[model samples]
Target: MGVRWILAAGLWLAGCATSPPPSGLPDSLDVSSRHELTEVPFFPQRDYQCGPASLAMTLAWSGLKVTPEDLKPQVYSAKREGSLPPDMIAAARRRGRIAYPVTSTADLLREVAAGHPVIVLQRLESFWQTQWHYAVVIGYDLERREIVLHSGAEERLAMALDAFEQTWKPWGYWGLVTMDPRRLPASAEPKKYVKAVLGLERTQRWQEAEQAYSSALARWPHHLTAWIGLGNSRYALGNLAGAEQAFRSAVRAKPDSGIPYNNLAHVLMEMNRTEEALAVIRQAIRLGGPQISVYKKTLAEIQRRRNS
Candidate 1:
């Protein structure tokens, strides 16, 4: 190639390599705030094992002494080539921690400032040749506009949040954090955590599910789903009294909804309170919730038990 042609190509590549990252941090973020959770252990990822490495870091901080190698089968996807969010969440729940996605940059920063290391995905290459990366965020210096991450082989990778946004923003600025059941996110809606607990119930992991639900209730006593879910966990564990109280709380939270009454009726029958069961079932039927037939069957069963 000609000397001038080579020089032109080199300059073009240099500009691409030094391209400035995107900008736009949330206005509500405290730019002067500086915080770091140094307690989270760093796990340097090997090869394309960022998923396992990041998961190990967060899980370890949440009180599990697990390693990346121990999580490969659960969080590592050999078929798709990398772990997805759902897999990461399931792995954390399996270990008895409440893990959920952070919905915004502010929420992520909130978690970090609160001493929780957050695992986030960042884009590592050109737009046309995108490379996905997972990194654990252990700290942030909002005054400097930098976010500290446990990225790749680096222990404390300080990245500009705006620049980090370029790499981390879409994928919905995807970030996940695993925390004790009693701890809740500062800026996140109560429903976010409640939904996470419900997700656990769906998978039949009701063991620690009650802890999360109770935690949710402690934070927002008016949360209907928390009450209902707590009832569900109690019922699953054969605690009829606790189940009944939860359902009653659910009933108080949303008087217009008949679901809690129906649930409470079933628990009453389980307790051999036949007359009370029939009365509650009748109230649920009067409200005409979605499950009419189910309520009718419950009422019939109570009557049959009472007749004999």
Candidate 2:
């Protein structure tokens, strides 16, 4: 978080504006792409607070009512005087938002095209003298070869696409698309989305995880992981019926796997369908890979319940 040092030295303005685009700018701008998310909120950064400001804008746009100051404690490093990328992602997840990292320049533009703003990390100075800063990309004009960002104090900083790429490339075109669980990014991959959902679940945000898993299943109807996660989330939230359906879907998605059967058995037991639970657990025990011991335990418990 050397971001504060850049501002103290009065180099913040010099970094993004005066620097020209790299000579090897890839010809990757989407044709016919001209979109501006005018509805996106902008929070002007105060001092080394670009990270908080950028995150605030995206989170608010994603339907959370947050301000930069409110997010400072979560994202800002008091020792570093700036925020780190990982902290920004963690902050989003804490608020039940999916903070998916955009891997490429193409993917960043796709997010903007789909009406989602992207938060990008930039090396505002030369490679030797790296100046890290975060900004929110709210618009792009491919014909004009420019991308609009809510940077520092500028509400709409129209940066040359090539220039933005030059600042972004050193960071591996690192960017983030933060949004609600139900809204998947335009360029989201199923596995990547599932990983993000897993992060949300790790935060114990079961309601958000449920929404994310449901959305994932909508896009990937037969995805085993989504089905399993959905069942788990619903079970955590005490929706035994929904959990039963989701686990059943997981069984369908991977019929040969014992994992789903085991989960289904647990949900059936919770619903007091002890006979059905016993049958399912016995199936899990028979079809088990490495979890046969756990499946056997389940069978034993069901048998005890029946005997009692």
List where candidate 1 sits over 4 angstroms from the true fold.
1-26, 30-32, 126-129
- For each candidate in turn, the TM-score is 0.87, 0.87
Tens-place lDDT per residue, model 1, 183-227, is: 775555776788777766767677688888888888789988888
After TM-score superposition, what is the CA distance of residue 98 in candidate 1 from its true location, in Å?
1.5
The candidate 1 region of ten consecutive residues with least summed lDDT is 5-14
Native-referenced Cα lDDT, model 2:
0.81
Best by lDDT: 2
Number of backbone collisions per candidate, in order? 1, 0
